[model samples]
Target chain A: MSQIDEQLRTELQRQGVWVTSMQDLYNWGRKNSIWPLQFGLACCAIEMIATAASRYDIARFGGEVFRPSPRQADLMIVAGTVTKKMAPQIVRLFNQMADPKYVIAMGACAISGGPFKQGYNVLKGIDRYIPVDVYIPGCPPRPEALLHAFMELQRKIDEQKLTGADKAEFLKPDQPSEFPVPRFGRHDLEPRANPNVFQPPVLER
Target chain B: MSATIETLEAMERPPVSMASRLQGELLEVSMGPQHPSTHGVFRMNVALEGEIVRKLKPVFGYLHRNHEKIGENTSYLGSMPYTDRLDYFCSMTNNWAYALSVEKLAGIEVPERAEYLRVILAELTRLQNHASLLGFLLSDMGAWGTPLMYAFREREKILDLFESLAGSRMMCDYMRFGGCRVDPSDEWLAQAKQIAERFPKFLDEFEDLILGNEIVIGRTQNVGKLSAELAVNAGITGPMLRACGVNYDIRKVDGYGFYPRFKFRIPLGEHGDTYDRLMMRALEMRESVQILKQAFAQVQPGPVMNPKAKIRAFRPPVGEAYGHIEAPKGELGFYLISDGSPNPYRYRVRPPSFINLTILEDMCLGHTVADVMVILGSVDIVMGEVDR
Candidate 1:
């Protein structure tokens, strides 16, 4: 099917007709009902809960169904400090989640270990293991920040192409659904970071 | 009819060999690290005889980020923000506990107005902590979301108060060694007074909704019963200790902060069961409101921070001091050993949630698997504090 012209589509809609593509319809359904995996690692989890509660009411966006099980979830809000001890389990949980899953690293800690970055047991960032789609920066970002991240995720989902060279990451058969779960090594997480998922820039001085 | 009678007789006579085979075999079940009801990354290893928990061992260190070690490495002032994440629910109390220890170590005196602000903030923290805890406990018992939403609705009001005064909702790093970071304006004080006055009405509504409900009573009453002797022996403090009819509140005992000036009663419970523990928090929230009212009324205009206290490069003299407070959960104490350095030589946190878990197994042993969640919820262990 050819792309509908904006003017023509508006004219048609005025004349009691509507125009939409299969991709648009699919993305519309997927974007609105993104079910987050109900998992919390630390303080950010409280803010995440506040976002879901009455005042913030995340259900307004149809993303309030926080599934306790990974299989039922489409979004993983890694909402707090990801310690080295919990990193393996978090990765395993990410692997357990079905295809077409998105991750929102919802705090400074989840993004780069935040204030506890200097701690021996803290994970540098969750992106070292599983790929994160959105990163919210705060010790524990306010609920409004989380809501903004949710909307940004929705926008990303809305823009996902069904069939094209620049399609969604999950759409590509070559893209791996499961990443390697890190192990607790002598001093740190084994293989400190995943080469496939995380690529840190090297400095030459 | 004869065949039916024979089958009934067979059913009455349990299979002797089968019973013998199953008698000594116990099933071990690990309940967390990712469980929604564990209230964080808390885990329990349970050895079960059928459905009853024969043995329960709580597994820790899932969320441990080496907080104490980090405190030791960081400067005295640098660690204030870190303390906010300790309980996460009651950051004000955590701040007070840490600041109290640092002050004792350095022989610093808190300003008069700062004491009033601290009292008010701490009480507000207690109100929200206990209120939200009940909601969480109920959620754990399977009445999910509605009670939690109601609790958070009220908690948001308190959080908004914190945010306006300190500029952060949850992580309010508003306390310093000798005083609070920000002084509330007169308008802010008026708003706080309003919230304090309105809190009891919400509590009344909350209690009316859940207190007399048969399901709540059935699930919590007589479940996870901790004896008074065992409670004291295990060093259980805070509402958990008070729930066992113990009158050992750190506020009353230590008489630190301007609590002696405030007229409030510690609500004690007769039975140390899950129900009593739940009620203990509710009653304590009421007491907190009373304290808030008294503090707000007595708060006078004065400098919030002490003039002599330095923030940037705070180096205390060589000494050690342990300062504790009646945190919403229990006795939140901070121990500091300073060696005339900006950073403390030793920094240790006496986390109530960690010590309170000593009796977790004892309370959960005879209870069913489902009861374990309720008991754990009543105990209210935040993983951040417990694992830290």
Candidate 2:
């Protein structure tokens, strides 16, 4: 008690109040209940099924329950190649989801279009339209790899200690950044004087 | 049998007027497009008469991504991965069939080691698919999760082997035109051998679990009995045809790769019923184990992929070829036409499941609507391949 009082007095002198009883409830909740939306588009969907099945058991991390609706889901596991035609739909779906949602772009197609990079229909990357929290790099990332993504998300959640009530603002598509564009052209250049009188003098001579 | 539509019309007097008048008597049921048991996005328009199916017309194209068209558009190397997506549950077999066809077109030879590995992987893929399909059949029969879980557990071990060897799991795309993607690493070889070694005991356990069970026999035996004539007419092959007492295995008949070198027995069935098909798959799994064991013992470690071959945007000489394999389902054939381009001009998949559906009406004619699902499951159609 005497030591606590002495430490409290020193801390109080340096700062205002030492409130040391704040529990990491926000992080814990975010870590334990990351609900992924059911958004499978192509071959990666098979691997996604394999991950959710008994062998990989994605349920162990509490994220195996896939929510069909985006509004209820906290995570979006994009499991396949998104075509150009499908990109707007994906963006619209992401926009419909509530705030505080994270995205894990699964497979190379979602990451950077994989082998279909040159294909006219394939999107270059899903991240161009929707923000990705994690990128699983594989042709179709193994189920265990998907689990690692979940674990990484958990680690991120813990590190950030993000509160449920945090009112984070989303950036608009047209909004300019705070950083200024570099000015290469200067406004200090002076205009040159004309030499028309010299030519007239030569002609007179 | 003739088409059910014609038969129903024949039954009515002044058919067109009767058809117009007697519309609501048939109970319409939409079975799929999202129903998990259909194996993919297939929709069945079943006209039923009080739980007895009168006519069932299969509707497809829900999962059709124009895989064949894409195959036509992409080069030989580029098209390899797309083959994996067709009947994705048994991707290695699909990969080999396509690769074999392309290899045939190019007049390329696969090395001995690569051939052995192909056989080993193809057999393993067969075993796993049959086991999984059996489990699925059981699920359709109301033995919900136990059998499916057991099947998946075995599948996981195989997939693990695939992952360690191929650098990817489900969609392996490991087969190249002339050879495979890579030789088996020492660790992978050891693991594959171990899996083969451990498989017989697991198969015995599987037999004990379901084969002797009275409920399984009662549900499956003498159900949907298709004679050898009917099976052949319907273009059934692989285990389904062999089960009907026909010894027409592509490996034995065509003598592909080192299949002629390996000594094995083909399992046959007398009745060609659902029980026979289930039993056929089980026995084939055992045969596959033997093939795997033989391959492991005989195979010499060497290059897995093709050497002195540059597959980048390579065009084939103008020709047409149909390559068929005795896949786990039936005869899976690729009819390819090359116009001296990087890609095939026309690509067609002679899907065994789709053709096998030719006999479905015959099987389901007198059976109940409940048995219809069972029959469909027994056929084991992969809609990706079917619609493609």
Tens-digit lDDT string for candidate 1 (A1-205): 3377889989999999888888988999999999999999899999999999999999999999999999999999999888888999999999999999999999899999898889988998999999999999988898999999999999999998889899888999999999999997888899899999999979999
Q: Which residues of candidate 1, in runs, are more than 4 Å off? A: B1-22
Please provide, for model 2 over B353-378, each residue's C-alpha lDDT reduced to its tens digit, 9 standing for 90 to 100: 77887678677766788888888888
TM-score of each predicted structure versus truth: 0.95, 0.74
Query: What RMSD does each model have against the real structure?
Result: 6.7, 12.7
lDDT of each: 0.91, 0.75
Best by TM-score: 1
State the weakest 10-residue window (summed lDDT) of model 1 chain B: B10-19
lDDT of 2 by residue, A1-205 (tens): 1124666766886886643313355567768988887666666766776777678878899987677677788888877766554455566567667766788999898888776666545566677656678999987787878999989988877666222344222324333212121111243101111122111125644
Candidate whose lDDT is highest:
1
Alpha-carbon deviation at A189 in model 1, angstroms:
1.4
